[model samples]
Target: MHVPDGFIDAPTSLAAGAVAAAAVAVSLRGARRELDERTAPLAGLVAAFIFAVQMLNFPVAAGTSGHLLGGALAAILVGPYTGVLCVSVVLLMQGILFADGGLTALGVNITDMAVVTTVVSYAVFRGLVKVLPRRRRSVTVASFVAALVSVPAAAVAFTLIYAVGGTTDVSIGKVATAMVGVHVLIGIGEAAITGLTVGAVVAVRPDLVYGARDLRQRLKLRVNGELIDAPAPAAAPVAARTSRRALWISGLVTSLVLAGFVSFYASSSPDGLEKVAADQGIDKRTEKHASADSPLADYGVRDIADARLSGGLAGVIGVGATAVAGTGVFWAVRRRRTGDVSPTAVENV
Candidate 1:
């Protein structure tokens, strides 16, 4: 959920900001190991896809709606560290450009939505994949479960954060119950979307899926009275490598379609957090967003007047900006990884 300003006090918000900063810093370092030729390119696309899917909010309850959080989906497609960065990028873009999330509360949103969800879901996914049958289907199953659990986990995280710094005097127990209950329904939707997306990619090109790497069951060979692991095959030709350009183009097109047009049909009800906040009086002290005056504020272009066209253009712009920003960040991370290796080292190899 996108926490708005004044929901949390200054001290707690600043503390959360520190935590968010630290998490991002750690993720940047870890991403160096996760992003390579194949994954590096896909990482940006994954961020854009998440940004698009999040616009299509589905109805969860009478007055509450939910959308894809994208932590599990991103983690399954890319990696945990990169997944954090992806969701963070989307949150940052929404806060600064769309005025959806408050700028002052950026840290709170990033901590609850980006860091918590990615950490919890990826941990669950890794754990399940280890115990379950090592198959492509298993990866999808794990993704579904991981996403399902991550939504509520994020809700719990928010509840705790609110308990510590909530501006209102609402009952913490009631808030927790309401938040968790609605989010559980939201989690089901998250699970389905994450599972289907991860499944589709794994089926098409498992090699491109960071989490699916080394998923094949190692072969065993009978050797002189012993069963030994078979030798790995030689690397394929550069020409044989599937071009990610096609997948990237397809994903970008799908993102544009979803955000540009499909988003119009999304439910109009308040999202899980918004509904809960209104019900629990959490917004009693909520302040206006600093970016509320931006041309693209509230997901509409200024002076467009046409609801469809305004929102559509805004969505398209959001997708484009997020893609460009995310691609730039990931490319820098990838380049840094390359720069760490000296020319002599590459020549030696």
Candidate 2:
């Protein structure tokens, strides 16, 4: 959820900011290992796709709504570290460009939405994928379960953060109960979206999926009295698969269509966090966003009276900007990985 300003006090917010910064720093380093020709390109598209799906907030309860948090989907498609960065990028774009999340509370939002969700979901996904049958279906199953659990995990994380720095004097127990309860419903939506998206990608190109990598039961051959692991595939086919330009183009187009048009039908209700905040008096101390005056504030362009066109255009802009920003960040990380290799090092024949 996008935490607005004044929800958390200065000290706690600063602490959370430090935590978010550290998490991003660590993820940047970890992504170096995860990013490659295949993943590096798709990582940006994943971010954009996440940004698009988040716009389609589905009804979760009587008044509350939910959207794809993207941590599980991204981690399954790309990698955990990159997943965190993807959500972080979306949050940044929303806060600064759309005025959806508060600028001052950016750290709190990132910690709650980006770091916690990615860590918890990816951990669950990895654990499950290891134990389950090593198949595409198993990967999808793990995605659903991981995403289902992650939404409530994020809610719990927010409650913990609020318990420490909530501006209002609401009962912490009540807040926790309400937060977790509503988000549990939201988690179902998250799970469905994650499962479908991950399944689709894994079906088309398992090679592009980071979580599916090495997930296939390694082949074995009977040789002389022993079963030995099969040799790795030739480099040429592998290289060909890595250049997933078609998949990349398809993903980008899908993102554009989702954000540009499909978002218009999304439920126009308070999301899980907003509903909980309003019900729990968490917004009593809420302050106006600094970017509220921006042209693209509130996911609409200034002076564009046509709500559909304005919001659609803003969504397109957001998707484009996020894709570019995310791509740049990941590309640099990939380059950093290559740069670390000494020029004099010999390549394995």
Candidate 3:
């Protein structure tokens, strides 16, 4: 949920800003370990895909809607640290470019949506993967449960933050009940999206999925009435490896289609947080976005009256910008890891 300005007081916002900054700093360091050769590339794609899916808000209740939070999906597809950066990038882009989330409340949104969701989902996902059957299905199952819990966890986090700094004098208990209750429905939708997306990626390129690394069951073979593990396949030639270029291109194209075209059909209702805020009077002091005058404010171009074309163009731009920004961050993290691993660097002369 994108928290607008004036919802939280200045002191609380500043405190949250410090917390967000610290969380991002820690993630940047941890991402070096997560963004290796294989995962670095997928991390960018995960960000782009999350941006696309988030555009498609599905109906959750009569007036409330939900969208992909992307923490669980990203953590399952890439890694937890990188996943936090991924969602943070999307939130940043939305705040600066689309003017959806408020600039002043950026820290609140990042802390609740990016940090809390990623940390909670990944922790639960890893725990479940440890106890559940070590299979591809287990990864998907863990993703579902992780995503399901993460939404409510985020809601709870926001409720607590509001209790401390809410501008209005609303009942904290009522606000918590309303927020958690609506988000629980939203969590089901989150679970399905996370499960399906993680399943699809794991099926296609289990090698690309970081969370599935330990779930690779060895292929069993019957050798003279005895069970034996099959030998691992040799690495493909460079030419054979180049064939995956098409897959990457296809994935980018699909992201564009989802964001640029499919997003037009998404529900037009307010999301879980917006609905709850309106119902609970938490939004009574909400302020307009500082960037509301931007050309691309609210995911539409300035003068393009055609709703479809304006929205589509905005979506395309969002996907392109998010992919580039995410790739740059991940590439930098990967390179830093390489530099740290060098002999001279490690030895410190």
Best by the lDDT measure: 1
Rank list by lDDT: 1, 2, 3
- Model 1 Cα RMSD, Å? 2.7
lDDT of each: 0.91, 0.90, 0.88
What are the per-residue Cα lDDT tens digits for candidate 2 across 198-305?
A: 999889888788889976567899999899988755454744564477789888999999999999999999998899899989999999999999999988889999
TM-score of 3: 0.92
lDDT of 3 by residue, 199-234 (tens): 987887777788998967779999999999886555
Candidates 1 and 3 compared: the better one by TM-score is 1
Candidate 3 wrongly placed segments (more than 4 Å): 217-240, 343-349
Error of 3 at 209 (Å): 0.6
Task: Give the alpha carbon lDDT tens digit for every residue of 1-349 in model 1.
Answer: 8899999999999999999999999999999888876678789989999999999999999978999999988887889999999999999999999998888889999999999999999999999999998899999999999999999999999999999999999999999999999999999999999999999988887878877886866789999999988865555455536456777889999999999999999999999999999998899999999999999998999999999999889999999999999999999998897899875553332
In model 1, how large is the Cα lDDT of residue 9? 93
Ranking by TM-score: 2, 1, 3
Stretches of candidate 1 off by over 4 Å are: 217-243, 343-349
